[model samples]
Target chain A: MSLIEAPRTPTRGRRTGGINWEKWGWIYMRASGVVLVVLIFGHLLVNMFLGEGVKAIDFAFVGGKLSDPFWQVWDGLMLWLALIHGANGMRTIVNDYATNPKVRTVLLAGIAVSTIILIALGTLVITTFDPCPAGADPALLASFCEAL
Target chain B: MPEKSASNLVAEPQSPPKIRSPKRPAGTLYRGNEGMWSWVLHRITGVSIYFFLLVHILDTALVRVSPDAYNIVIDSYKTPLMGLAEIGLVAAIGFHAINGLRIILIDFWAFGAKHQRTLFWVVIGIWLVLLAGFIPRQLMHVFGG
Candidate 1:
């Protein structure tokens, strides 16, 4: 004769004692997603829908925005959050579809490398940006460039 | 008596095993309902947004190169074709954002799972309203000047 456990009895745990990276990753997606929605929407509204809309966008427009410390922080946060969020999402998709171990490894590596490089590059561009560069067409410069 | 017992212990002839198909054809959670469709659309839009983000970051990085370089590249975005593409990009982002919120609600809220079917339509309703406000404004910007 055998005895059965109660309905509410706890079962043996599947996960070993360690960090739960997957759980954190899952939480990161939703958290970053909420932030990115605000960041990216504000980005689009300012860059694409304001005043002259897309017509008003150019080097000058970007220079003007990037020159401002507020936008610098905005773009920087957007860059890190959105890139990591997207890279993680792509990792999930790749894990699902890429059946071959080698193929999956390669795809995952590509995502990781690209995300790192872009994040670094984007941060550099935002931090060290010069609104007005010398020997450039003065006509194309930001309006504030005239004051400078 | 021993020989008879040995003969009885012999195994029966074996047959080739047949592969058993699952009782459910599509998937466990996939019932062609709002849940399934919402999941599918979320993935599609997520992927599209990812690719666009990569390109967008590169374009913006051109600012560090030179004003001429950045302006010359960004100038192409004002073209009629790219203008239309912007609409699609915005649509994807809007859907992804709203639906992402819906997904969060389902995960955290007490009543969310029970009302998820309703939430999917709510996501669509909000997405449509956003696009309605955006499209006309964008069209005038794209085709106006």
Candidate 2:
């Protein structure tokens, strides 16, 4: 076995005139890396810098942010983009290291399943979150929610 | 046996396992081991940050479950143990971000590709300064009484 595996499959193999997934995957890493920096840093700054800093963070802080659709979309985008980016990176690593074809298939399947499930759950939470539910105890709700 | 050897010769024509010094194109410079180290670190930081992202998303999503539920998870992070972990998270993110920028520059800028070693050092220098600068402030926030 060589230190680096032969470039196989889509990167260097016979093609039947279809979309080049490997090329797109390469492009996706660079593109998503750029965006994740903004989404991630903005997230850190807001959570730990603005307002009263990390000390102010609690259910209310998160609840207030989720109440706004702007933050919801921002959070949702961060969720989807970063998850896919991470999953794709894992897939590349797995492909590079996994020597056995059957083992590789199983590993890739596991990644796909976990990534799909997390993305679904994350998207659902971000979009459907009701910071102040009708049935929740008034005492537990954010003060702003009490007005409603 | 003779037929098999003939087929092996044909296959070797394409796969060419022998060491062959291919011509360097008109004008290009080698980036050396420093370039290789940068590639290795980039991948390592990427994987580390991705792992952090997984845990982070799960914790924040707990907010939607219930206030008590979320508080249970988040409040635990205030412990000294988790505070120490925060330092590691910040370092991973800082390295990944700067190295990512280096990669982007190398990809787009013709000069960056030529001097990627220099760019890598620049990335490291910024990362150290940021990490050094962040430690005092963040440690205070994390472990401050």
Candidate 3:
């Protein structure tokens, strides 16, 4: 009779559960990174490169842009994407460095709270922004305000 | 060559035993399992945003410095092309914010791995809803409504 060696069993204390989370997170990073490259570069090119260049930026300029629906939508997208990306990125850092469970929890909570607050405030500013308010200090107000 | 005295044969008395150090198993800098890469990218983005914020604040402060200068800057924002630039900014902020929420949930709530797919879809849905509302409003402004 011939003897054969049996296959070795896996070591004890290995984590179990069917789902693979790390893989998915990695994929999310790459995918978001790709999209971010396009969005970020495009944003810089238009704001800094085009038109009269960097010197052309100002309140009336912003008011004028916001006055148009196109700019509003554009600004809105940038706000949403960058904020979420940043928040997600921080979450990753917290998970990696924060060893204590309680500490991790606190850190994560802080990130969430801050992100939500910023998003709410930013969106409000974009949607409710007034290019030309009534009865403002004439010197402080833009030309459009006076015209109104 | 003859048998040396016991004293001579004895190896020079070794230095008094120093405190023994504990053996430490090797630890990985990054977890080999899922999500490690994503976590790394998140940190990079967070730091980038901080830098961007400083610049943005300074630029906006220019308005307070000189209205004429501000108006010159503002006028540049008036073009149709500039409108598109704003779109890019909105997209960046939107994606970052929604993804950030996801990271928060996974870390704090102990959202199991199984639910990651669901959460991702939910984020996309929220983004779409916001975009829908924002786009039309922006277009109206551009068209001189």
Candidate 4:
């Protein structure tokens, strides 16, 4: 075993009943990774490179996309997948590096707590956002919202 | 010839005690079940998402600064290149979300692990279906206008 290896690095990780969570976790990483590549790239291409691209983004712009149920579902899925994927990856990192049991626990805890909070906030923003509020200063509102 | 002491000859090779187990012959690792494949994809997607997240949030935050500032940047997205890029993002999201569901099922559902391989295929099937639904509409939006 390497100096930092968990003293007993099971050739295979522990099991629960007949299940092996570690194996599953590993599998989850690869599967998610492959999918994320396409999702993330497509998202970037559309948002930053498509019509009007980055130059067209604004309160009106985002509001327009969010207004559509299609974009809503798309953004929501992206949020959940990215957050969980990131959190799981961090957990794996913590497991690999934080040899001290207490340190590992704390880091893992932080990852979980932070990830959950971000997911909640992001989802809420995507779902509940309004491009123009009734009482907001007209100056701040996008001109497009005037049509609504 | 030098005097070969028993201790000198015997101790040197084994002193480090390199516990070498027989390594698996190459492709055996890759030939494993769905779990292994999933793990690999998850790690890769996890890393890719991290990079995308950084850029996405930075741009999204621009909205707080000023509408004009944000719109200027987003306006660039209308190009043909970006439209093509959108398709790629749909494919990625479709696969990741479906695969993620499989994982969630394995964790929470009683039958998840037992039928994990079947579930794996189901994930792919759903992903393709979603893509089929999503692509044409997205293409029209991107290219038609």
Which ranges in model 4 have alpha carbons more than 4 Å from their true place?
A: A1-58, A63-85, A91-148, B1-31
DockQ, candidate 3, vs. native dimer: 0.12
2 or 4: which has the higher TM-score? 2
Error of 2 at B50 (Å): 1.8
Candidate 3, residues B1-145, lDDT tens digits: the string is 3456556657566678787765864446436423554454445546666445534534443443455555655566557786666555455455555666676566547663457656767866887876775555555555443
DockQ pick, better of 2 and 3: 2
- For every prediction, compared with the true complex, DockQ reads 0.65, 0.35, 0.12, 0.15
Kindly report the docking quality category of candidate 4: incorrect
Which stretches of candidate 2 lie above 4 Å from their native place?
A1-13, A135-140, B1-32
The CAPRI class of candidate 3 is incorrect
Model 3: residues with Cα > 4 Å off, grouped in runs? A1-35, A137-147, B1-46, B50-145
Residues forming the 10-long window of minimal summed lDDT in candidate 4 chain B: B24-33
Tens digit of per-residue lDDT, candidate 1, span B83-123: 99999999999999999999999999978888999999999
* Best of the candidates, DockQ: 1
TM-score of each: 0.86, 0.81, 0.47, 0.53
lDDT of 4 by residue, A22-126 (tens): 788777765665566566657656765476554455577677777789888877777777668677877887888898989988999988887777777777677
lDDT of 1 at B63: 93
lDDT of 1 at B59: 93
Sorting all predicted structures by DockQ, with the top scorer first, yields 1, 2, 4, 3
User: Regarding TM-score, does 3 or 4 come out ahead?
Assistant: 4
Interface root-mean-square deviation for each candidate? 0.7, 1.8, 9.4, 6.2
